[model samples]
Target: GDANRAEAALARAEGRIPDALFLIDQARIAFLEHDVSGTEDYWAACRIADEVGSTEIWLDIEVLATPEEHDTWDRLRTLPAADRDACAFFRRFWNRRAAAAGMGVDDRIVAHYQRTRFALDHYRRRGRVRPRFAARLGRPTNSVYDDRGLLYVRMGDPDEVAIHGGSDCIEPNISWAYDRPGGYRIYHLSPLAGVDDWYLQENLAIVYRCGSWDRNPMVAISPLLLDVPGQPFHDLYLSRMGLDPRYARIANHALSLIGDAFAGSRLAEELTVEREWTWQDGEYAISTVPERPAVDLSVDFALEWLQFRAPRPGLTRVWLNGLAEASALQPVEKEGQDVYRVQIVWTLLDETGLFYRFIPSSFDAAVDGPLDDEAGLSLRKSADLPPGTYRWMLAISDANSTADGQGKKVRGGYAGGDVVVRDLGTDLPVLSDVAVSADSVGAWSPTAGISLNPTPARLTGDDGVAFIYYEVYNLTPGGMYETRVVLQPEDGGPSFDLSYPGTAQRSASIVTRGHLRIDLSASSPGRYEMSVTVRDLTSGHVTLPVRTDILVTRD
Candidate 1:
C-alpha cells in the first residue's frame, strides 16, 4: 500500500526537486522499516533524478545505513543516472545470490533487510558517536553503528554472543564465536571510548588485564604487552591452563549463560583465556577477511565441453557434459531413499567487466544398484552466449553440505580455464567441436534433429562403437567432401583413422551436418584423443581439426 502511494506521489512530482525530495522521504521511510531493496531503489531513483540535485539527501541516506552499506550506496550514487550496466549488475548480483539461497530475489532482499535491521536495532550505538573513536568503530564518521554493528553488517550475527561485564580488574567486553562453516572465528570487543562506543580489539589480553597495573607509568610497557602469541586464541589459552579445573567451571557457566551448543569446552577455554591476559593498549589493527573466495575440494571428477554456432548471430551454444564419482558426493536420505544432491554453477568473466553466471543443473539422484566407485551421476547443460574472451569456471558442490563462513556451499569439484569464442567465417570451412555419444543421440541446437547426448566420461560401454556428430560451415554447392575421424592413444600406441568421401546434401549457404560411427571395440581400454576434420575435395579446402579427449573403460 505504501509503495503504491509512493509511486503515485512520484508521478505527481515530475520536477527534479519535488521528485528528488519525495524519493528521499520514501527512502528514509523504507530504511526505518528495514527495507533494503526499497531504500536502494528509492536512493538510486533520486540520484538518477538529478546527480547534482542535493548532497543533503545523499547524507540522509548515508546516515540511515551501516558504514559498509553507505559505501555501496556511495558507489551507486556516483555512477551515471539509470546506467544500464550498473542496473544490470545490481539485478544480476541480487538474482544470483537469490538463486544460490534457493529462494526468489524478493525473498533474498527481505532476508538481507532483516539482517541489517537486526544490526541497526541491536548493535547501533546507544550514546553519541565520539570523533576519536570513529575510525575504530568503522568508516564514514557519521555512521551511528559501533564496532559490533559494522561487524554484523559484514558477517551476519555470530552463532554465539556473550556480554561479559568487567570483573574488578578486567575491562568490560563482548565475545563472539562462529564455529560452524568456515572454521572457527572468535572475536573480542572492548568499549574503547566509553560504554556505548565499542571497538574491535584484536588483543585478547585486554579482556582480562589488570587495569590498575597496566596504567602504572613506572612499569616498562612493551607494545607486545597487548599481542597474544597464539592464533585461534581458544586453543592456546586452554593449552596454557594445563589441565586446570577452572576450565570446566567457565565452560559450564558459558553454556548456561549464552546457550551455545558448542560452548562446553571450547567457550570455557576461550573464557579462561580472556581472564588470563594483562591490560595493555594494543595498536588498533583490523583483520582483513577476504570476501567469499571459492573453496575448492580435492575430489575426483571429469569434464567435457563442446560448442557450436548458435541460432542467433554472434552467439555460440555451449554444451557441458561430464560425470562425478560417487565418492565426491555425500548421500543424504530423502523419502526412504539415499540420494546424492549436487548444484552445478557455470560462470564466465572477462577483464572488460563482462560477467555471466548460471546454475546449469541441480538435482537429487537416487542411489541405484551399487554406489559406484567410477561415476555416481551424469551432468549435462546447454547455454547460448555471445562471443568473447572469458575466464570460465565450473563448480559442482554437494548440495547437502553446510554453508561455509562466506555462505557458499563447500564445493566438491571445481575447474577453471580460459576460453575464446569467435565468429566462424563463412568463407572457409570450419568444423564445430565433435559431439560424441556412447549410447544414442538426441535433439539439440543449430537444427531440430541435431540433439546428441554427449557421452559421460567419453565412455563407450559394452558397445565398442562411438557415435560422433559435427557440423561443417561454408560449403560449396554439390561440393565433394572427405570426412576424416581419428582415434589416437595418448600413450605411444597404434592409431586408427577413417576417411569417407561424400557429396554435400545441403545448399552452399547452409551448414553441413554429419555423423560417424567409429568402432573402438578392438581397441584397448585407455585414454584416447578423438579428432575430426572435413575437407572440400573439389576446392582443396580443409578445416582445422578439432579434438577432444575420451576415456574408454574396460568392457
Candidate 2:
C-alpha cells in the first residue's frame, strides 16, 4: 500500500498518472467506503481472501475416492516410472516376447495391467488418513476395514517374520519379499539388507530400476511406529540398548540394510499392467485383449481358475483353458454397485490334456466381503488346498456379453497366473535338516546333498527367514513326507496341508504331484499350528521336531 500509493501520489503531484492507477484508488476508496479496515495492508490480503473464501487461497481436504471405489483404490502408488530408456526397452522386449508366444501386444499388456494397478494401489497413498470425515483408510489394515487384505494374503503361516543384520555388511541389500500378501513382517525395504527407511515417497522406489539400482529403501515409510495390538518394536529397541548399548547401534544398521535390500529386489520384478476405467467419468471407451492358461487337476491339486472375456458389446463362452465348459456369472449389486464375477472349478479327465469337469454352483468371486459402492473383481480361495499349481484364467467381455443361458459367442480377452500349494499341514515324514535339527526327535535321517531352493530374500535387522534344504531320494525306492499343519485362532487365519511327491514330475505334476493342505473357512481369522511327522520310505528313516506354530490374521 505505501510504495504503490507513494508512487501514485508522486504521479498525481506530477498531474500525469495513468488510468490503470484508477483501480488501485478505487480499491482504496472501497476499503474506506466500506470501513472494513483502516489500511488495505498487502500482508493482511491473505487473511481477507481466506475470510472471503477466495478460490486461490482456499484448500479443500476432502477425500477423493467415492464410496463405491474405496476397496479398490485405498492403496499407495509407489513406483515412479522407470527411466525412459528402460521402459522403451521393456516395451520392445514385450513386443518380441509376445510374438514368439503367439499373443498380441494388447493381450500381454492387459494380462499384466491388473498387476500394475495392484502395485500402485498397494504402495500409493490412498487418501488423507483423516480429512473432514472420520475415517482411517490410509493405515495398515485389519480384516473389517480392508477388503484387499486377501489381495496380499499370506496363508499357511504367520510364525513371525524374522530379520537379520550382519556386521560390516553396510548397505547389503536383502532384496527379498513374498510376491503376495500374508501375515509377513516386512523384513527389508531398502537397498541395504536389514534396513527400514520407510519414506513412502515415489522417488524412493525408483531406485529399484534394473539399470541403476538405487541404494535406498525403494519406498521408506521412515521410522514410524505402527499402532500394534501386541508387541512393540520401539520398546524392544529400548530394552535391547539398555542390555547392550551396541545393540542399539546394530539394530539401526540392521533396519537400514533390510530397507535397502527390500528395495533392491524390487528391481528384478516384472512390471504389472494396470488401467483405471470409469463409465461415470467420461464418454471414453476401453478395449481389452485376452489370454488363457491350462493346468492339470488331480488329488495333488485342489484349486484352479479360468478367465473369460469379451468386448463392450458381447458375452463370452466359458471354458477350461481352451476346453469348453459350462459357466455363468450373474450380474448383481456388490459393494453397493453392480458387478459380474464368477469362479470355475474343474477336474482332470484325460492323461494328456485338461478336461472340463464340473462347474460349481457358485458364480461369485472368491473374495472377502461385500463390495461397498467401491468393489472390483478379485479372487479368493474358499478352501484349504493341497500342494500343486492352481492356474487362474479369466474371460472378460464387455458388460453386454449376455448371449446368455446357452453360453456362446461370448468373447472379450483374458488373463491369469498360477498359485503354488505347499504342504502346510499334515505329517512331514522327513525334512533332511529342518530348521532346528539340534532338537532331533523321532524322525528320519538326513538326505545328504539335498537342496531346498533358496528364495531370493535375506534377513536384515532382527527379522529372519529359514530355508529347509532337502531332496526326495527316490519314490521308486518309496518315499513321501506327510506333515499336517493347522491354522492358529485369530479373527482371520491361514491353513495348509503337507504332501511330498518325489523329486521328479510327480512333484510338479498337478495330478500326481506332492500335496499337503488344510481346508479352512475364509471368513475366520487367527493363528495356525502344524503338528507334522516325516518318514522316509527309501532310507527307512523318520524325522522329528514335528510341531511349529504360525499366526495368520484377516478381516
Q: Which candidate ranks first by TM-score, i.e. highest? A: 1
Candidate 2: 10-residue stretch with minimal lDDT: 270-279
| Residue ranges of candidate 2 with Cα displaced over 4 Å | 1-395, 398-473, 476-481, 490-534, 537-555
Per-residue CA lDDT of model 2 for 353-405, tens digit only, reads 12112222223433333444422332222232333454433333324244333
Using all chains and alpha carbons, the TM-scores for the candidates as numbered come to 0.61, 0.20
RMSD of each: 9.4, 27.3
What is the lDDT of every predicted structure here? 0.58, 0.28
lDDT of 1 by residue, 224-269 (tens): 1222222222332332232234434443443343322322345434
* lDDT accuracy of residue 195 in candidate 1: 71
How many steric overlaps are in each model, in order?
5, 148
